[model samples]
Target: MRVYPEQLGRHLTPLAQCYCLFGDDAWLIENARSQLLEAARQQGFEERISLEQDSGFNWNDLQNEWQALSLFASRRIIELTLPQAKPGADGSAMLTGLMAQPNPDLLLILRGPKLAAEQTNSKWFKTLDNAGVYVPCNTPEGQQYFRWLDGRITANRLMLDSDARQLLATLYEGNLLAAEQAVQLLALLAANRRVSAEELSQYFDDQSRFNVFQLSDALLGNQQQRVAHILAQLKAEGTALPIVLWAVFRELASLLQLKTAMVQRESLAPLWSKLRIWDKRKPLYEAALSRLSLPQIEAMLALSSTLELKLKQGGEEDWTLLTHLCLLFDASAHSALVDTRG
Candidate 1:
């Protein structure tokens, strides 16, 4: 049986057999593991959860451990964390046989990064899928993510007005786990008080690690002073170049999405709720929306891709690329769009 993170909340509690969780989202996988471990404990398998990683050990040795039963406990959970699993000859043979007759009282979990279709259909993958539950954990996106964030806020007993939530949504830049942590921390920080847009902005501007959203927000708001300041702060804080590049790319993607939605006569107001754009930054988004068109935003996103490739290949001039990105967004905000598709 396949399970998504969205359905895990409901489906997990009733699971009675061996299972495997496989997904790219580390946070979701970890959370799922925690739930399973807890549930197994409640079901009187307190000492069943055993963790293993693929890097240092023989798979057969670990397999044998899962084959053994606890003297005092009726069931056991064997968690194998292999970021990338390649079954050696011995491991492959052992796993193939194990699949034929899964231990009735032992649950086996295998987790790793995302796999291509070919990899997903590999011997071990198919074996796990057939013999036990395979929960695929993909990162949430778009409206699904917003719903997740809103749910998190409510779970924390912190009320986020639509605008405040939107602000946080934008601030998180699609990193749901980080966003969740930030909200939990904020809830503790403002115990017994509701979070506001103003409060969020102050924290975002002051404490946020540099990323695409921060840079784009700085540029969009026409805060040249802040932009310079943030770039310096990022350098001081030792943020990696590629991480910053990814964030910039994410911002460019959002801008393109925002532009496309607008051109389609889609209501930008709802996007605030969908994108989790807070009230304070809605004006900034509105201004950027008012100025940029779909074509123009797409062109800049194209430029971003080119720059990203160059940066990845040890392109000697990252500062130049950064300046160019800033200038393109700046130009979009100013005067009318030039037909620069040439």
Candidate 2:
């Protein structure tokens, strides 16, 4: 009886007497609810009633609603939104009783938050589920996240190459509502054309208040606390993970290059100019180099590479990796973390 949001349409046919939609993602749950209502409407479910379960909600009111006849239309849909996702003793008995004696003219829909394992295994839930459809609307993550984005793009009649898709994904990885809005804007402005990665700038402005440059300065200066603070701020502001990764990766690579040349006793002036290390910023690099050896720089570079790989593979909590990579510049902080783990 369990159906995913993607497969709801296929199973919705023949129209089950009742449906239970529950999830952690409000957007997904709302979307599924709309789909179910539209299907009900098509099958002559002209009259609709909506109820939100609250502190004062009475199970008897629902029973009365189910028993009473609707004058506006013979076919009716009753939607009950459960904010608690918990139907206590009274509500449970009522639901099980109603399940045993379903009204031929009524289409019941119960929408609620995600349920715990114990709740799912309860007798009342199992009974209700046996009589109808149960759709879990959890948000997709990792590769599934990209698949959802791609589906949205196709449904909106827009074409996006791989780069453009990645760009769109980065812009709204955690903020699905905003991502949906952005896609709608794109559809209205320019649908049916292949969107390049570079063109995304026209529609969505940079929403991040803090830039990665600040992070770089903090890292090279070996300011561990400032690095952590800046990373947290960036994540809070919805800064793209890849943008942050590239900036840190760039710094790590540059440090490795400079550290290697210094170990080989190479000339500093030409190397500084070639690496685009400005005169004012030379002091920061020099100060960092004073304490770090070749091995440390190489190790940092390896860690940066691992971070990049994780980002591409869709690491959970990418901000943590970003924070770790940047803080590695401070040897004391890195050593403290190692000691603590020991």
Candidate 3:
């Protein structure tokens, strides 16, 4: 069975014995995991929960924990976190095989960041898709985001009037984590009082208009300052270089797909929605499509390929090359577009 984050509230009642959760947005996936865990506790699975990370993961340890069950317990829950699950790797291979014949007595939950675009259509991903539930945590949009906010409000046992809800939505945009936190703060502020829209700012001063989505949008908008600011924040947030590269590559790949489909006389709108790109990213995507042709995209991809190899091979200049690569791509997009116009 497959479930979306929007359907999670009701669909979680019938969680299968195993699940594979992965997507671009981290907050949504983490939110889904929490909700599922709470539901499991309701099903009397509190004490049986076990967690594991992907790095230095011991197959024996996982198998042992999963296979063993308390004589007194009805079911065991195993939650595995894979920060990165590349295709053909040992972890990905083992998981692909395990999902083929998941343990009936155990509820195996796998969480990971979005697979690289190149790996999206891999056999392992296909296997997971075929074998069990997949909750893709791509960024929620528009009314879906409002609905998600309402769900979170209700979950936290708080009340917000219609106006208040709309205000909160506008303030936080699509930032799930920040929105949830802001609502929690509101709940605390109005512990026994009914919160209204007017009182929102009084309780919390929300000051974020450029989140990850906006940063991506800035790149598309060709706003170098905004992009630079975002990159700095990303660095401060400890975002991995590989993760940043993956996101940029994925976006570029999607644009290439959209461009190809457009040339083929197919609809690009559906692809945009399916990609779960926020409204702010539309201009960015448009700009990128205009700025980069197929050949340019291929060139950038080739550059990333070389960068990846160099990083793996190791050297003092690897860091310098990575910085240069990011700058070169950034400059290429802006300069190439300008030159085309000139």
State candidate 3's TM-score. Answer: 0.57
Between candidates 1 and 3, the one scoring higher on TM-score is 1
Query: lDDT tens digits, residues 42-62, model 1?
Result: 766655545555467776667
Query: What's the TM-score of each model vs. the native?
Result: 0.63, 0.64, 0.57
Clashing pairs in 1: 163-278, 166-276, 166-277, 166-278, 167-277, 167-278, 212-247, 212-248
Per-residue C-alpha lDDT of model 2 across residues 1-342, encoded as one tens digit per residue: 898887898976768879999887777888888898888888889999988889999999989889888999999999998898888899999999999987768999999988899889988789879999999887675578788888888889888778887778766764567778888988987766888888886678433234688678778888786577668778877788888888887877777888888889987778788889999789889888887777777777776667667666666446665676677787765564442111
Of 1 and 2, which scores higher on TM-score? Answer: 2
What digit string (tens of lDDT, one per residue) describes model 3 on residues 1-342? 568976777766666767777886778888788887887777767555555665566766666676676676776777877666563466566767677667656677778876666766777777777766778887666567777877888877787778888778766754677887897887787776677888886766543333555555555566665466556666655666666666656766676687788678898889888887768667767776776666666655666666666556762224344443344345365354322111
Q: For all candidates, what are the clash counts?
A: 8, 0, 1
- Which parts of model 3 have CA positions greater than 4 angstroms off? 24-27, 42-55, 69-72, 141-143, 150-166, 187-197, 207-342
Best-fitting candidate, scored by TM-score: 2
Q: What local lDDT score does residue 218 receive in model 1, on the 0 to 100 scale?
A: 77
